[model samples]
Target: MQTHAQIDGFDPERIERDVRRWLERAVIGFNLCPFAKAVYAKHQVRIVVSDASTERALLEQLGEEMALLRDTPADEIDTTLLVHPQVLGDFLDYNDFLDDADALLEALELDGVLQVASFHPHYQFAGTEPDDAENLTNRAPFPILHLLREDSVDRAVAAYPEPDAIIERNIATVRGLGVDGWNKLLGD
Candidate 1:
């Protein structure tokens, strides 16, 4: 377990608060991710603050988090956010690290059990500009390694009326919010 004293530069409390704000205000408030509210309401979201300053350290931390998640029961903890503020500040670097993340999952033999979804302050889609409004859908106050259970995702997708439409709907939702609106919501 990482202690508060371990984190440097950014305050751990503030990171937790910001993550909650992003989850409650943006994700759940805007209904961007329809499944978020249920898990959040259930208090099953585990937010871990990591102090890794390098990609190698972050990967080690990620491995620890994955092991923790695997050891814990689903009823006790459904998901985890490996919130790292030190490394992968650049969106491109974070994006590239995801490949290694996948490889780690395979190495751990957890490829089908758990998967990572990414969120960053500057999340961008292919062929889209950095400032594109649609990217805000995945944007957060800091770069986040969202580890999710594959079973939960499958259940959510199976229950959703139009799971395939989720991306398009989220894109339209973000586009409708626009840059100015998003900035205001983000308190920029």
Candidate 2:
């Protein structure tokens, strides 16, 4: 892995801070992911800043992240956010790359053991317009590959009253916030 200084303008600390803001101000603040607060407050969420500029490089980093997540204990790390700044800037291109991520998990035989969730600045659900407020629910400051443990997710879902409602709830929350509210929350 290259040092932050080696990767042009790739400041891991800054990236981490930006992610934290998203988590605290958006995720936790809006209660988008109900289970996020516990892991975040416990400091179990791992934020990995990757400066990979190519698909191959990003995949290599993804391999390493999967290995780390598999090897590490749950107590030490419950989840990980693979924040890649250089690659997959275009939402459509990034959306396409998710297939590769799934394939990698399947190839590694971690399909059920691990799940990959996606978040991007321009996250747009299928059949939704670009300006739709519902899109903000999955939108982030940058492209993020959220690696989660199936066991943890299962537990969280089991505890959650209605896991399915999360989407509508998030949409409603963002809609209530509106564009100005979102901009203010993002400190834009």
lDDT of 1 at 20: 91
- The per-model lDDT (C-alpha) reads 0.89, 0.90
Question: Cα lDDT of model 1 overall?
Answer: 0.89
lDDT of 2 by residue, 1-188 (tens): 88756567778778888889989999998899999999999989999988799988998899788878989999899999999888999999999999999999998888998999999988999999988899999888889999999999999999999899998999999999986788789873
Worst 10 residues of 2 by lDDT: 3-12
Instruction: Let me know the TM-score candidate 2 reaches against the reference structure.
Output: 0.94
TM-score for candidate 1, please give it. 0.93
| Cα TM-score per model | 0.93, 0.94
Q: What is candidate 2's local distance difference test score?
A: 0.90
Per-prediction count of colliding residue pairs? 0, 0
